[model samples]
Target: MDDLDRKLNDAFPGYVVRKDLVKQVRGNAAVPSYVLEFLLGQNCATDDEEQIKLGIERVKDILAKHYVQRAEAGAIRSDIKQTGFQRVIDKVSVVLNEKRDAYEATFENLGISRVLVDSDTVKNNRRLLVSGVWCIADLSYSANEAKDESPYLLQKLKPIQMSRFDFEGYAEKRGNFTMDEWIDVLIRSIGLDPSQMGKRAKLFQLTRLVTYCERNYNLIELGPKGTGKSHVYSEFSPHGILISGGEVTPAKLFVNNSTGRIGLVGYWDCVAFDEFAGKNKRPKADIVDIMKNYMANKSFSRGIEQVTAEASMVFVGNTSHDIAYMINFSDLFEDLPTVYHDPAFIDRLHAYIPGWEMDIIRGDMFSSDFGFIVDYLAEALRHTRALDYSELYRDHFELSDTLSTRDKDGIQKTFSGLMKIIFPNKEVTTEEIAEILEFCLEMRKRVKDSLYRIDETFSRVQFAYRPVDGGSWVNVETLEEIDFPGTYHARDLVPLEGESVDEAVIEVAEDHSGTTVQEVSAERVSVPAIEEKTLFEGHKAYRENQRGVSFDGLFGDYLKGARRIEIIDPYIRSFHQCRNLMELLEVALRYFDYKAPSLEVHLVTGPDDYDVAKQRDYLDQIANAMAPLGLDFTYEIDMSGIIHARHLKIDDSWDILLDRGLDIFQKFDSGNAFAIENRMPEMRRVRQFEVTYLKKD
Candidate 1:
């Protein structure tokens, strides 16, 4: 156990289990994570591995033994009768018997209904009775009930989530850990390896975490499929309810007019609509209008009565097109069905998470570190909704006057949500505040940027905003625009290194036997020149442009005496950033004589602001990739906390600081290895970047 693991264990001794153990016991239950974690919390919370294994086996046995399966419902009923009392797991729903003035539990799969439940159970666990619940219910025979009616009575039951939590204690305990430690704990507790996720990706994810804290907050995210947009709402919290987009109706979401009963909002803390995108899924316009109004006002009218609910709304969907393509050709809401594309409805959204910025779902992305049992975190967030944390940022900075009242509201809501997730204890600094502010603005800007491309009437206001205290206002545009304008501006290459290596050209040739030529390009060369000519025939012309350059030319002379090279880019932290670093190294290797002089590379880059462990993981991945080549590529995290500039250093004396560094390429097509641009180094698309060489004084 690391610092956090020990802390969590010490604080909640005998009640906290390693989060990953829950997943192991869950197997293929198709149940929510909270449900599995609840069982784990009850049985495997202890730190002993053997005890945990035994507990997991016991839980599995319990589920397999008593859980009602639709395929074997008849067998389960027999067991309940034969055993007299059976503990069964199933989706439990309840209905109020207004005529009898009592509540009855209904087991869906077991085909049992009206199992008399005590009033205390219904009143105390209203959440379980309100929505679907996975529970362990004690069954007993009740002969008084008719044969057609439920004969088995629900004697005792436990809801999956521990309803009661110490919110104040949770908040107080949060003060003990630093922001980084807290982030690590949160990531680990949720069973994720924080080391694998990137800072930007983590920030994007934490934005969603805010829903766990705030009430009536509306957020929407539309991007390519399989990004795990629905995962959090579906499994991260028991308080949240995830519904299929098409399956939900106004009655289920808002209020059921037939019974005058409030809908999901009255019960769930967070309600998410899954699979919300597509051009053909025709959602009722009236429903969208009602949702827009309810999202803004936190109230809805059902029949003659007006009802208010505190549920935060989340919409997740898949986009048919890439972000760049949509931004250039259509609007941000292009994936939204035409009926739901009204600007008024879109404007109701508080933030638009850049779904395109998220990586595709992969197994390696899951974290196994310690985080709050999500149900506990959800309970904490339910209380946090009442506490205002947005003012912390306002104390240091102010928003622009040009931002409309509605726009400011959107920004502040997002800011508040982030504040609650990252600094729930209210312990943060100016720099941290700035990062959250920048993120808030960027999220809102994603909405605005897409709007501009979609509707001609939408004004092309600067997707820009200013901070109060001191610093330049930033445009929420891609980094390519700021650093590699000459190249990304046109979204194409300008051939700055025309024909040869633009300014520092490297040339390679192959002999009849097809071996790499060792002679350097004559247009530009170091202090020394190569004398070989026989190896110069059948040479192919290539250019070292900003985006993706051919590695063959850069490493043609590695067989010489260049043994140690230093990479000094400032942006090698994220997975994509690491990929860029790997590409550069691959190019540098072409010059090495594999049989004789082996090459070694070293990297020094900036530390990630969101999480440091992820930075370390990226470096390790790079090292692993070069291990086979006998290349020793290592990285040391920059401690200066002020290196924003991107650059490169070779050996020790030769410094090649890049204006754009490695993250100069535009997003690739399909992100596949076999893509033409990905396979052909020279053809790979890249943004324009300036490389300047300096010698040691």
Candidate 2:
């Protein structure tokens, strides 16, 4: 086990299970991850290898014997009949059989119906009465020929979820881990490794959980498929239910008009609608009206009575068009059905997650690390919904007065949920609060901006905020707004061939192979020759996975005509970091004269704490490669241990502060030489970063 694994075990023993263990025992079993993790949490929650092995075998044995498969349902029923009684794992849903004056339990996979269930069982497991819940139930069969009675009988029933959790203890122990550690813990808890995601991308995943941790928060995500949009709601928690968007009915989601019974909103902490973005979907008018009321007022009309519930709503679907096309020709909510495209319904949404920023699911992204058995994490998040951390940013920042009450509510709910998940203890720094506040504003602004494009009556309002401590008001813009400025906001409305909406010029190429050409972004084009280009002084932000960006265009003018350059970035120790430095040097080479007497570039960086020898060797390689090119490259271990500032100093005048330094690009197919991203830097996407050009006074 690594340091994090050891720390997790030491901090909260018997609550966490190795994430990879889920796959080992989940062979062809059509069960949610929480159901499997519940079993694993009971058996293999310890670090002992021998105990884990035994527990794995025991769990596998239990599944093999008890878990029901539709294909083997008949054989299992025969076995139950022969044995007279058997315990099986399957989804169990119950409905009150009014005529019989008893609740009837139906085994979803066992394919049995009309089994008697006591009222107390239905009351204790109310969620099962709403949606089918995975449960381990004892069943018995006694061949009967009666018309109203069946031989199949339900004995003891147990819902496969965390029965009890100590929220106080969980919150107290949460203080033991730093913000970064806790974020990574949540990332791992969701089955993805934190090392594979960036700060922005990690937040993107965490935002999906806000619905679980906040009341009445409505969020939607629409992008290309395979980004795990529905995974969290379906697998990570028992408190959330993921149903098909088309499958939902007003009776199922809100209330049954025939029977005075409540639905999913009354039972689950979060109700996520999967495959929600279809242009042709025909949702019922009553459901849409009920949804708008519930999403906005958190209450729906039920036969002259108003019903209220705390369940947050989440909508996940796939987009047919890319971000640029949607932003230019239509709104971000382009994929929604015509009925749901109502401005009133769209305005009720709190946030629109930029799903395009998330990388598609990859094998290496799955974590094998120790994390909460998900059910435990789910309970903790559910408990946090009762607490409000929205005012945490009031001491440091304030929202724009232009924002409506709905806007404020959306922003506050999102901020509060993120705080509960990240800082459950309610302890945070000002910088941390600012980051969350700005992110909240940007998210809400994304939704509001689309409203302007969708509805002419929606007025444009300034989506900006300022620090209460007296800094300049900061303007917020969605990543798409910055990436496609000319075509976005309905400007220019068109792009001619061989030109770009952002600034990365496209080169025209011919298709000589007698086939259709494939168009790809060329972000990493070679550096242009030095010229009298104006070097602007300001800050710019880039989004993760946003293409058409490179060091050549970012700082080619700043590095031009410099006799001496000092790049002070503390984390240039890894192979990728070193390669990033070499690429930056390549950009500077095109700007500087090779025949110049002293083309000096010294990097102030930190040694790799894990492997300093390897770090030095990589640095040496850069020095050797640069020496032959007439650029004297040297690096020194800052040794200060606090070289947090990443910036480049040119001739003691120009200073370019880098938020992510030279390592701004996201991981890609570096080993695959033929990959377009490897051949063209412009084709590669970048991690969210900021760069500021400042002249030293």
Candidate 3:
């Protein structure tokens, strides 16, 4: 085990389990992950290898004997009759047999019905009436002479969920792991490899869980399919339920006037709608109206009574059109049903997860490392819902005064949920608080920004915040604003006095391959550009899918007319990293005289610990290759282990700081001779990173 694995084991102890173990024990049992993990938590929670092997066998044996398969239900029934009683794992739902004036249970996959169940069981597990619950059930069969008497009997029943948890212990142990480690642990617990996701993507995945941990929070995610948008609500927790978009009704979601029985909102912590976006589909107006009220006021009207619920609402859907197409011609809410496209409903949403930023679910993304048993994590979150961390940031920072109460509520709920997930101990640094606060603002701002385009009466507000210690305000902008500037700026119906609307409008033509090419006119709207000094110096940021950025465009102006340059980047050890260094050097040579020996470059980098000799060989190859091109290249290892900054100094005139150095391009098919990105770096899709330029005194 690695350091992280050991720390997680020591901190969480028996509550942690290897995530890959679920697959080993899930053979043909069509059960949610939480159900499998509930069993794993009982048998295989320990870290010992022998114990885990034995637990796997024991679990397999239990499943084989108890788990019901529809194909073999008849054989199981025959076995039950032969044995008189048998325990089986299946979905159990209860209903009131009105004529008999008694409650009865039905095993969904076992193909058994009209089994006698006590009223106490129905009262305890009310969810059985809505979507049913996975339970371990005892069934017995007997021959009966009377036609009215049923032959099946339900001997016992137990829901497959965590019965108990220690919230205080969970909060205390959270101190052992840093925020980043905790985030990675949560990511691994969700069956994802943390190393394969970026910081933004990781936070986005964690944001999906906020609905489970917060009350009445509404969220929406619309993007391409296969991104696992609905996976968490469906499989991660027993306290949440996922229903089809078309399957939802006022009776199932809010309240049934006829029975006076509350619906999903009364039982589940979160109610998520799957495949929610379809322009052609029509939803009941009454359902939409009650949902809007419930989402905003946390209450719905049923007949003469008003009912309230704490369930958070989540909508996940697939967009038929890409982001740019929607931004230019329509809006982000384009794929939602006509009823849901209303501005009031859109404004009620606290956040809009940019699902396009997520990569499609791939096989290698699954983790084999140890993480908290999901049931344990689910219980921890459930307990945290009662605690209020919304005001945690008030002492450190303040939001803009122009934000409405609704906006403030949305931001606070999101921030509070993130704090509970990341820092349950309520301890954080100023920068840490700012990171989460800015993310919260951006999420809320995405919803508001779309509202502006959808409804003209919705005036815009600057989503900025100021630190209590007195510093320049930090303003947040949606990534779509930066990527589609022309479309974003053209949304205003009334142009400024000096600017023409024609100039702001840019036409985008998409080809058969779905590649967008923009055609801009000289006449355009004028908006205040973000101050470069505020962004480039001492401020950290991120950019994604940025194009037209090359070595010349990024650093050529700064490095021009310089005799010497110093490059201090610690990660230039691998072959691809060395190739990145060579490309930078070529860019430098293009600026200076190629035949001049005065232009010198020095690299201070860290050596590859696994193979120092190979690192030296690659650096030497770069030096030899550059010497022939009249550029003097020299490299040295930083033995002090303190050279962490990635920056370049050009003759003491400018300092260029880079978050990812020259290795910004994502992994591509470099071996393919026909690949354009292999030959031209400009053709590559760069990973999300940031670069800053600073001028020396």
Candidate 4:
């Protein structure tokens, strides 16, 4: 184990199970990951190889003898009859048999029913009434012709869940991990590799868990297929139920008036509808109306009375069109069913997760590292539903007064849910609180901004916030607006009269640290206008997956009219880093005039500790290649080790600070010669980073 893994093991101990072990034990069984992890958590929670091997064998033996497959159900029933009793692992759901005045159990996949269960068992494990529970059950059989009754009997049943979790212990142990480490652990627990995802992408994955923890939190995710949009709701928690969007009815979701029995909302903590988007799929209009009311008020009307439920709503679907197409030709909610296309229904959603930003699930994306046993995490989240951290941000920042009550509520719920997930102890720094607050505000802003385009009556609201300690308001915009300015600022979807939307013009000014800064008007009034050049060099931030960035756009104007340039980046040793330097040189050569004197460039970088000779050779090759282009290149190592800042000094006129130095592009297959990104720097996807332009006056 590496340092983080060892630290996680030391902190979480028995609760941390190797995520890959789930696949090793699940051969052909259709069991969900949580069930398999529960079994593994009991036996193989240690790092000892011998113990893990033994545990694997024991788990295999248990599955072979107990796990009931549908095809083998008949043989298992015969075995039970012959032996008079047998133990099996299957999904067990109980229903009240009014006629017999008893609760009867049904073993799904085992295809057995009418097995009598006691009232205490049903009451203790009430989840059995709605969806079901994976349990280890003992079945007995006895022929009774005189009584005219079936012989199937439920002798004993144990739901496959952690009987008890130490909530205090869990919260206390959270202090041992940094916020990033905890986020990584949570991502791994859900079977994803955190290393493969950006910070925003990881947060998006964790946002799906908010519904599991926050009461009545409504979320919708519509994206391309294979992003694992519905995986968490279906497999991560037992308190949640994932059902087909088309299969839902008012009776199953709200209440059955005939039987007067409460439905899924009464039993489950979260109800998610999979495959929920499609114009052709017909959903009951009445159900949509009731869902909107419940989502807003947390209560649904019953015959002569009103009943409240704490179940959060989730909708996951695949979008048939791309985000740009949807934004230009239609609204983001275009794919939803006609009944759910109402503005009121759309407004109730607290957050809209941009599914298209996620990468498709690849084989390497599954982590083999240690993570919390999902059952433990599930219960931990469920326990946090009662805790509220919505007001935590008020200590540091204040939301704009222009926001409506509904908008404020949506933002608060989202912020509260994220705080519960990341800072359940209610202990956070001001910077940490700001990060989450801005993310929450942006999510709700995405929903509200789209609403304005869809219905012009909905006036635009400034989604800005101010620091309580005193500072200018920090305006937040959806990353979509930054990346796709043309589509986001289309003239047809203009803002309301008397309201001005600030169009951020990103200009690369020559400065010490070439940072991009927005030029805001004194009245805070502007209009949305698309500019050809989007890259700025003064003082601005860029989100991950944002496009329209190139080397020329970032440094072209800054490097102009300069005879000498000094590149001071320490990470210019690796082959990829050298390639980035070479790309920058190419950009410089293209930017400078051939008629001008030779442009001199000097690199002040750290040498490779392991292979200095190879690094020198690469630099020499670059120098040699650029010699014919009227560019003089030379290098010097920083033996002082004090040159930590990554900035470029151009003839004492501008200082450009590069947060990621020259290594901004994400890793790609350089072996593929035909790849366009390999030849064109602008076509490559960049890592999340920031650049600052400081004037050297």
Candidate 5:
């Protein structure tokens, strides 16, 4: 077992099983992940593989004989009738029957409705009725005449996850376990193995845990699709409901004014809208307005009375365009329905998860070591809602005065959510607090920047906070500067002229390739034919936001006798990655006019991991396509380990050191290929790449 698996085993003792065994015992049973993990937790939450295998076999046998699916519902009913009592696994949802003076059970898969449930079962399992509680139900049919049906069955239900948690007792016993062990217990409780997750990924998982702890926190995620945004909301919790965007109705979401029936908000702990983005898809204005109000105040108006609910709201959507396009042309929230794009509605959101940063969902991302049952974790979160963790950060630092009330709220909510998820026990350091604070600020800034793009009237505020210890204030925007140089404008590069603050405004440029940058000595240098080469004088055009500028226009007019051009980049494999190389060739092709001058383009790149056969196939196709256009492409993998500089040297002179190299375009979209910019090469979308030219030594 891995350290994480061992830790879970040590933490939960015999109650936490490896995540992989849940699937094994599931066999053909169509159940949620939490249900499978619950069973695994009961019988096989152990490190002993032989015992687990045997336990899994037994569990499978029990499920196969008991679980009710659509095809076997009739058989189950027949078995219950003949045997007078039979155990069956099914999703049980309970509703109050006023006339009968008892709660009735609704079996989703069995197609059974209004089955009379025992009073003890109803009263003892009030929480089970709210969300789908997977249970082993004993059905006994009686030949009694009722208004709705001639025969009725008594459902003696047993929930898989009973309310057995002793929160106070657990709090008392929590001191026995070390901090790392407690973290493992939390991980095991959520049915996940910590070993499989990286530090950043663990933080993300913790962020999702806020839904369990906080009440009515509004979270929105917008990015490219298939990032598993809806997975946790749909599959992790019985207390959470995932509704399709089209299926959500005012009657279903809020209280129904007609019959005075409370909706999902009254019952579910979290309500998530799947596929929530699409500009053309029109939504009800009333829905948006009511949601805005509810998200802000945790209450909605139904007739004259205000009905309050604790259900957190989640919005998951896909963006048709890349981030750069959205940043340059429109706001990030532009993909949202026009009705939801209102500033009031946007302001209510606590955090905006940049779904693009989340890696695409793959098989390996799932944990197999151990995690708590998601339902159990969800219930724990629901209980934690009463606790306020937001104030923990105030003692250490102060928020910037420039930030608005909404901005401050966003930051605090995010900080609280993250704290509740990660540092629930309040065992953390100043460094850890700073890390999470930075993340919270970034999430809030995503919302702020996108909103700024939509409405320029909003003033730019400093997303920084000062520590109380008289040290420097932490700035989130400065972190962006560390991550990307293009994040800062050219005018921001003015060198400071003071000896006192020399180190404070120092410029640190790291060139690991051993190429030293000498200050320009233009006064001593004599130019030969440099004045005659005015090719780039008028054609040179550079944009502030452009990732990489094509040098084709700059040196094309002066490339009459150019021969060999060498380009280097460490990473160049994907189609987009290769397009960076192709762009370089596009620049090189400009130098040749008469018979293309037999121009040779040599590319030194790392070895491709995406199938050699496919690479050859793609290159062959490209060669065939570009052969008629007088462009020759040749590439070699670097095995010598000699070259590390990312520069393009033309004929041993006129070198260009590329900061971001040539992979300048933002993520591509196949759906928007018909757009004019996509069709037009020059007008094609490109990201930031810096190029500085110098004469070769």
Candidate 6:
């Protein structure tokens, strides 16, 4: 085991399992992750190789013997008839037979129905009434004389869930890991690799967990498909139910007036609508109205009574167009159905996760590392719902005055939810508080900003915040706003400090904003204006997975007239790093005078420790490639290993500090020549980076 794996195993014994084991044991079982992990947690939650191997064998034996497969249902039923009783693991859902006055159970994969269930079992596992719960059940077939009683009997049943959770104990153990480590632990628990993500990206992933832990929280994520938007609600927890967007009805989600019975919202902690963005989808109008009231008030009218439920709501679906197209031609909510397109419904969303900012699901992104058993995590989250950290930030920061009560509430709920997930012990720093508050504020701001584009009647609340101790009001803008500032803010945007709102910005915005960003009902704000991209002499931060950033845009204005450039990046040995160096040269070539004698670009970098020869070869190739374009590229291997600082010095006048050197962009489809990001650097989502331009003495 690696150090982190060892640490996790030592700290959280019997609560975590090697995550990759799920795929190994799950050979087409068609079960949720929590179900599979439940079994694994009982058997393989250990670091010992011998015990894990034996556990895997035992679990495999159990599944082979007891796991019900629909295709083999007849064989299993025949076996039950012969043996008089059979133990099977299957999805069990229950319904009340009004005339018979008895609860009937259906084993989904076992292909058995009309099984008689006792009132005690039905009352104990009420979730079975709302959604199919994966459970181990003892079934016995019976040949009865009564036609209505030709039946199977349910002897016993156990739902696949963590029966007990200690929130205090879990919160206490959290201190063993740092904030970053804890975040990684949670990310791994969700089966994603934290090494491949940045702070912002990690936060985006954690926002998915907020819906589970925070009661009545509303979140929507609309982006391109295959980003795993529905994965969390579907597989991460047993307490959450993922339903098709079109399948929603007032009776299914809220309450049935006919029977006076509660629905999914009353039973499940989280109810998610998958594939929710198709404009053609005709969900019941009543569903939209019900959702509007429930999302806002956390209560819905049932006959003559008010029914309250704490179920969080999530809407996730494929966005038809890219962000640019949606921003220019329509708004981000373009794919939402006409019925749900109301401002009242949209306003209830506490946070709109920019799913486009999420990296697509890749096999490599799944971790083989240790993570908590999902059931444990789910139970912990379920227990944490009772705790409210919404006001935790009041001591550190305050919201903008322009924000409405709804906007502030959204921010508070989102912030509180994140705190519950990340800092369950309620231990946090002022900077950390500011960081999360800003993130949550921007989330709500994204919803608000898109609302403005759809309907200008929505007030332009400055989505900014200030530190309670004293600080300038820090403005929060969605990443889309940063990329497409002009149209993203459709109306005339307040200019940056000292810069006049000029016709030039408007012209640029109009020219660039034509072909991009979503939807249906509101009159879209079509005034496309660009915020000036003028460079400054201070630090500039760029988010990971955020597009519309390029080396040319960043360095063009600064590197325009330089004759000589000195790049000291110690870690330029890898192929991507070499590509970055090459791209920087191209940026310089785009603006520099190629007709000059030669633009000298020299680099001082360390040799690749693993493959020094390949490093030399790459550098030599870069030099050879640049020499022909009247750009003399040279390099020196700083064997002393002291050259760790990365900065660009041009013409001995400007020194630009690069936190990540020229390797700003994340790994992408460079192999696919057709990839637009390969041809246009601005189209690429960058790795989180910061640059500071300073005047050298």
In terms of TM-score, the best-performing candidate is 6
Ranking by TM-score: 6, 4, 3, 2, 1, 5
RMSD (Å) of each candidate, 1 decimal: 11.8, 7.1, 5.7, 5.8, 11.5, 5.5
lDDT of 3: 0.84
lDDT of 1 by residue, 1-697 (tens): 7777778776766556677676677765667777777777777777677988898998898778876778888888887787777888888999888877778888888888878888888777777656777788889875663554577877788877775778667767778787777776676666566665545556777888777787788889887888888988888887788888644778778877898877888988888989888888888766777788898788999877778888899989988886445533355687887777877777678888867666677677676545566667777777788877879877787776656666677778888888887787788888888777877876776565445434545543444455665677565554322322222222111224455444432222232234643543233223545656332222222111233354343333422345788766667888778877777777666666677556778777888878889889878978988888878888888879676776555556455556666665544553786788677765554443444555555
Cα-based TM-score, every candidate:
0.75, 0.88, 0.88, 0.89, 0.69, 0.91
TM-score of model 2 relative to the true fold?
Answer: 0.88
- What is candidate 4's CA lDDT for residue 692? 93
User: Considering lDDT, which of the candidate structures 3 and 6 is the better prediction for this target?
Assistant: 6
Model 4 lDDT at residue 417: 93
Q: Model 4, residue 63: what's the lDDT?
A: 92
Residue 44 miss distance in model 5 (angstroms): 0.7
TM-score of 1: 0.75
Please list all clashing residue pairs in model 3, or write none if there are none. 503-523, 503-524, 504-524
lDDT of 3 by residue, 520-632 (tens): 54343345577653323444444654444567666776666779999999999898889889888888988886455568999999979798899999999999988877788
Per-residue lDDT for 1-697 in model 2, tens only? Answer: 8898889999999999999999999999999999999999999999999999999998999999999999999999899999999999999999888888888888988898898988888889899788788999999888889887779888899999887889889988988898889899999999999999888888889999998889889998988999999999889898898996545888888999899899899999999999998888888887898899899888998899998999999988999988766865677898999898989998999999988778899999999999999999999999888888998988778887888888888899899999999998888998888888888888898898787766766665667778886777787877786776543444123356776754543322222223423332333224557886666888887777678898888888887788999999999999988888989999889999756786899999987889999999999998998898789998899776987989888898898999888998889878887988877888778887899999888
lDDT of each: 0.70, 0.86, 0.84, 0.85, 0.66, 0.86
- When summed lDDT is taken over every stretch of 10 residues in candidate 6, the lowest stretch is 503-512
lDDT of 2: 0.86
lDDT digits (tens) for residues 553-600 of candidate 4? 788887766789999998899898998899899889887877897999
Candidate 1, after superposition: displacement of residue 295 in Å? 1.4
lDDT of 6 by residue, 1-697 (tens): 6788888998889999999999989987888889889999999999999999999988888889999988998999999998899999999999889889988888898887878889998888899997789999988877778877646888899988977788888998887888899999999999988988888888988999998889999999999989999999999999899997546678888999998989899999999999988889887878888889999899999998999999999999899898878876678888998888878889899999888888889888999999999999999888888889988999888888879998999999899999999999999998889889999999998888777666657756778889888889888877777776546665433344666544213212121224432321123334446886555888889877788788888888888878999999999989989988888998898887866888999999998989999999998998888887889999999899898789999997889999988888877878899999899988888888899999877
lDDT-wise, the better of 2 and 5 is 2
lDDT of 5: 0.66
Location of the lowest summed lDDT over 10 successive residues in candidate 2: 505-514
